[model samples]
Target: MLATPRPRSTFSNAQIAAYFYSPCRNQYDEPVPEYFRCRCWKIRKQTSRNGFTNLMQHVRSEHPTFQEEMLAATTAQTSSVAH
Candidate 1:
């Protein structure tokens, strides 16, 4: 059986921030609020509370390796920075 190809880990912090911030306006030209532009918003809009809970539950299940890589990158960045 062919293994599923992993999603690329090439997304940068700026790209992740942009996804959460969604600096672009919506279709009606209304700006999307920062609070409503994130994965949280997507979860809220796309599913019920139970579904949202389930979705989060399986995040690492679905992408365990990616999550580990992201955590390592974040930890390295935090450690490298001086107060």
Candidate 2:
């Protein structure tokens, strides 16, 4: 018997860290630390400057098929919730 594929939403430690520590520009044009930003915030800035391309590369190299599986699972969950 074949094993069933699992739904994927798991993100890497680096990606998770980046989500919280990245800066957000405020209405006055001053950058505000995100609510969860900590000492690692500077590292996130240096790493994420290239944006999605950089992220996708990280995902591809580290997580392989996880990115595609995550997208599919998110889409499925969103559609189901909408209905």
Candidate 3:
């Protein structure tokens, strides 16, 4: 059986931050508050205990391997900086 290809794990913190912080505007074109914004699956941020918990879950479920790689990369980067 053919295995599914994994997504690239090179997404930077800036990219993830951008996804979370991307403005959610209303029909009036005004920006909705972060708490009210739907981060994924058209589910509002308020649905989760924390504004980002559900969004992060979506990432974890949708891109499990990539997320693991991202965490490893982040840890390596941080350790390198401390040296």
Candidate 4:
């Protein structure tokens, strides 16, 4: 079987920083890599959680423009693969 290439991040660092981060810091004063928090305006800033679920939900609910961007990108990839 052929190995599929790994995908890169679709959004830029600035775009990513606008919505999410891992707030907890270690002894070295660096953010922990495993945990993440959603920083959407519509919802209260919550406890930093794990995974993309919270971030995606924030995008879908609080940020329509971004959600559309994500859908468009995914749709393009899907159509390309189907051809």
Candidate 5:
């Protein structure tokens, strides 16, 4: 039997890292970080968390503008590649 294919991520690691800074790093960029800084909170410190589910939920709720921009960029890149 054929193995099931995993769905590709809508957000790339570089894009995600640029928008949300990750704490953990290594020799190479292949390994994803364990935590990401939140863009919200106008205080002395920012929030951080592990896993994409939390990060995605935070983006969907707190950063609609960023989300829209990412979507637009992704769409443009895909269209350009198709042509």
Candidate 6:
């Protein structure tokens, strides 16, 4: 008997990460570290291992607009909920 084709999944098919980051696979198409070729500064900086310290620093130092907007939004949200 001939094999039948399988149906594609309807759920968990969306990947938001695919938009922000580039392909991080190795020679064998395997997953790599989270901080690979990270553009945390003017030039891409590669970390020895996976961590969020660099990313946090990048947001705090590189994106002043983001910082101000985030602070304002956070203050508004918190003050609304405050007693």
Question: lDDT of each prediction vs. the true structure?
Answer: 0.41, 0.44, 0.50, 0.48, 0.49, 0.37
Clashing pairs in 4: none
Question: Per-residue CA lDDT of candidate 1, range 36-58, in tens?
Answer: 34344442122333333433333
RMSD values for the candidates in order, in angstroms, are: 9.8, 10.2, 8.7, 11.7, 10.2, 17.6
Candidates ranked by TM-score: 3, 5, 4, 6, 2, 1
Model 6 TM-score, all chains together: 0.30
Worst 10 contiguous positions by lDDT, candidate 3:
74-83
TM-score of each: 0.27, 0.29, 0.39, 0.31, 0.36, 0.30
Candidate 2 local lDDT, 1-83, one digit each (tens)? 98988454455445433432445566996775422333223222323444444444444455555545444554343233321
Model 6: number of backbone collisions: 0
lDDT-based ranking: 3, 5, 4, 2, 1, 6
Model 3 over residues 1-83: C-alpha lDDT tens digits? 99999565455433443443355678998976653332443544534346555555655566555444445555443333421
Query: What is candidate 5's lDDT per residue for 1-83, written digit by digit as tens?
Result: 99988456466534553554445435785544454455463111223444355566565556656545656665454333421
lDDT tens readout by residue for model 4, 34-55: 4445544333233346335555
Quote the positional error of residue 3 for candidate 5 in Å.
29
In model 6, what are the clashing residue pairs, if there are any?
A: none
Off by over 4 Å in 2: 1-49, 76-83
The Cα error of candidate 6 at residue 68, in Å, is 6.1
Better of 5 and 6 by TM-score: 5
Q: List the residue pairs that clash in candidate 5.
A: none
